[model samples]
Target chain A: MLRSWRWAAVAAGVAALVSLPTLAGALPTRSSDVTAEELRDLVRASGAVAHEAYGESRVDLPLPDVDALGDVPELLGSTTRTRTAWRTPLDWRVDRLTVAGETDVVRAGALTTTWDSADRSVTRLLGDLPVRLPRADDLTAPVLARRLVATPDTVLSRLPERRVAGRSAPGLRVAPADPAQTLVESVDVWVEPGSGLPLRVEVRADGQRNPVVTAVVLDLELGDPGARRTAFDPPPGSTETTTQAPDVAAEVDRLVPFLLPNVLAGDGRADPAGLGTGGVAVYDRGFEAYAVVPLDRDLGGDLLELAPPGGVFATPLVTVLVGRVERTAYVLVGTVPEQVLRDALTALRRDPPPFVGDR
Target chain B: MILTELAKLVRRPRTWVLVALLCALPTVVAVFVAVQEIAPRPGTGPAFLSAVLDSGTLFPAAALAIVLPLFLPVAVAVVAGESVAGEAQAGTLRYLLLRPVGRTRLLVAKLVSTLAFTLLSVSFVALTAYAVGVALFGSAEVSSVSGTEFSTADATVRIVLTVLYVGWSMLGVASVALFLSTLTDSPLVAALGAVGVLVASTLLVTLEAAAAVQPYLPTRYWLAFIDLYRDPVLTRDLLRGVGLQAVYIGVFLAAAWANFTTKDVTS
Candidate 1:
């Protein structure tokens, strides 16, 4: 009987030992000697390395109900789980997992392949998409880190070591040097010490209790998946279609009648996405930056007229403004204060910047 | 003694009935999907069901998903819950103990038999689903969820891994039921008690308010086997699920042994 009791104790002890390492990792560890500048450089260099990761990204941005937007609103307002094999921004694959099935968007060289599991079809699009909505790809740790650092006046500081993605990664905090310029409170990033990869990122918009966005790498490997792995090899019984995507920059530059200002409010015009195209423009040098879309006069006007909550929809973290300035109707969206959007709309309606526009 | 217990379990009519019920569900679903020629829109129904029509190779995976949430766990709970309790209720356990079978050995035999039942039931369901799927839709091309074609051999490997994962998860349920079986002579009460834990775990797992304790819940990573179909098989959740189930199996089996070996044998 006593031996049986000892056996029970032994079993319980083994269970405790199994849990000990995970519990110990939660305890605060010593901070690394890396500086903020060095971490920034590391993150930038990490972008050049070929690697793959699987992670879950969460966005708490509340989207307004709009008929014109289809599913874009729901897509931006929920958690996105993905597995990525990235060689470069132009050549990568993101497999989005959902309860229904997996949809893979693979970019090989100049063509992007979207494989739909339901239809058993592959659609390949040619050329880079000049301007696109935020996607699962944009919410990953490394991609988000690079975007955060692109903000002109962000100040970086060293933070204590934190465990993420099953590894101890040193932390770096990035905030705007001038607080009044952006809506972002701070961006916290944890880096893989060896590869310099950003393993986790948490973004807190101003005045929000919870981080507005969080993207963390749950599993990672630091080697190229190779060209063969990156290539789109459609299996048997799968239908394939290839379509040429119109050059958005050239089309927008040639078609639109009006112009977006070179600068809006106190912020300068900078397109971090490099969408230097004419009709589509993103303003501001900070996180408070707003995007300007030159919609066709009739569709833009009708959408602005039908927008709910009095032709302006606002979430705690994001704001959208739509208004008509004569024949050229515009939709302005940003994370800045509502006043900034109004001012940008007013500027679009009023004095237009002549920064290299032919029209 | 373990072999005897397993033979006794295999001889029971209830075991075959449970296995039949588990397989019937996926067969019925495959029939409807085949006859209608309309699979659930991507991301609407069970995980792999949407793609099963596209590639019948996913049928076993889809079948696992169909029964995993409720049927398999309930079946495991019922058999394990009846293991020791049924013997006690029938007044055979005390006599068997008197016949010189060690208390710890009896408990070990009972646990092994329950594990065998889990394995038997899960594999039977997979085998049935594979036949139904291949016959109805045909497995000319085996495509993974990530749009890559898996060789027939590779597909079989994934199905095998899924079977092992589902079996391991069912073992967690069996341990809970077996522990309850040792606590009471009433088989029904033991089975109900085991199932109650699963029901509560499932309910709490889906509740956002229960987030703090969700990770520790038994069913937290139950469906993680679906991650195996991913292009580069995601093993993080699989490893965690295995570890969590191991902890549950360890703690509960120890408790059952501690109680059974020392408890008064009034029956």
Candidate 2:
């Protein structure tokens, strides 16, 4: 009898362990888990404003069960160890607007990017791309939307079987490839059966239940896919202006006079010590007079991006924009001349940043 | 004579055992924490400490909570119930009473000794927990769920205050046990009876019908320890815990003294 009781206890423990994954798999799914065509149809039915340009698309991603890499010391003198990582779900909002089907992308707010379909080029219209946004920082909806569309492929997976919004559906669990360093781990989006529309989205992380972002389509409008093509047009008053070729020697000379005067007059340093370091480096990337004034911090990064051609005169520092391109934004700091600044910008636009190739 | 008797009482084998147990508690807890740290699935040390504090504080406030309704009161009862009744059961009470010392003085010394041991034990637990936590997790800033972090200095102060508050919470249990001890000649009977009261209170606290009565229960003050960890500190809860403990201590001591002086000791 005692032996049978012991066996029963062991069996119960084993059964419990085996059933945990099944229990976890029993979570809800969203309408987006259905076919892409069905989802498009549901969106069309939802009475979403047709052809009305919405620059910012806010997508709330609910990820449950984010896998976090566990801290395990490397074994046998190796610097890597195999360990089960910590996993948690995450609540994420992506605010980027997709301009229908022109292959053109525009991200507004901090770290703006504009894709010019005519030139078949992507432009960092504002701030910087691939820049890490600090937690809780307010960013424009478009910027977040781009991030959502550009989510790592490894994080996207096939949907799981579940019920969502009173409908049977499948859900997808999205996670970064490297479980470690994942800010958001598991987001389960449940797609409506047959319609392929997203009905519910749940995010979980670190064994804590996070809030879900759910969207229900009340109406759908599918316009003529071909008739509503968007045409790219530059602003009415914005004119295309071509600048003169760069003169490396003359540009360098202009920069030296301006930089030397400020360095000598300043309080021992070019910028504040704790804030960050700033320096200028000239690269001969096939361009005549390309100058790169790299700011060590983000505060001045935006200033350098938006500085006018003559010079940006912020207190304690000034920078003159030489030229701008899709990837490269060139600036000369101190008392550089207008011609020199224009020349440097032209060179930078032509030559491109050295790290552009790696990116 | 009373002072001499109390001093001699302090040197008794049981008294030294209690002190040694209290002192050794930190080491044992440290070992347990270290083992957990080295385990395959280790919980975050700081998080575990916070959870322990939460459990400790919330449990006493609501009788249905885990700590006060179960573990803490039982621990207090076990220690306090063994005090006078153990002496009586060991045939030492006759010798102790034959002395010129008054019953009230004897009871006072015993109560003081028990209270001292309780405080020492709590302090040892906290110190050991902190030391083990530091050794394993390193001395870093403790971050709360709200994202606000406490520096090492603040964390230390908070931990000390938490432990002291919990000690006062336990005093209520100790008084109940002491009172029960006076009624029983058999140490086991006294200990079991004290523990039984704790178990019954826990059951009563859990019952739906007794839910309204829970606020008045002695175990309700257990969560008062959490007041120490709050940012501005909730002095109201701490004051209430202290006041309730004072009442229990006073009432139980009075009852014990009255019973010892009047009751027959011919067992």
The CAPRI category of model 1 is acceptable
Residue-level lDDT of model 1, residues A157-210, one tens digit each, is: 988888887788999999887767567889999999988899999988888888
Chain A of candidate 2 compared with the true chain A, TM-score: 0.27
Error of model 2, residue A197, in angstroms: 44
Report the C-alpha displacement of residue A229, candidate 1, in angstroms. Answer: 3.0
DockQ of each: 0.48, 0.01
Where's the lowest-lDDT run of ten residues in candidate 1 chain B? B140-149
* TM-score, per-candidate, Cα-based: 0.89, 0.38
Regions of candidate 2 where Cα sits further than 4 Å from its true position: A1-359, B1-47, B50-75, B144-146
Q: lDDT per residue, candidate 2, B95-166, as tens digits?
A: 888878777787877787667767765665555545544554455444321112456576667666666777
DockQ of structure 2: 0.01
How much is the lDDT of residue A9 in candidate 1? 94
Interface RMSD of each: 2.8, 24.0
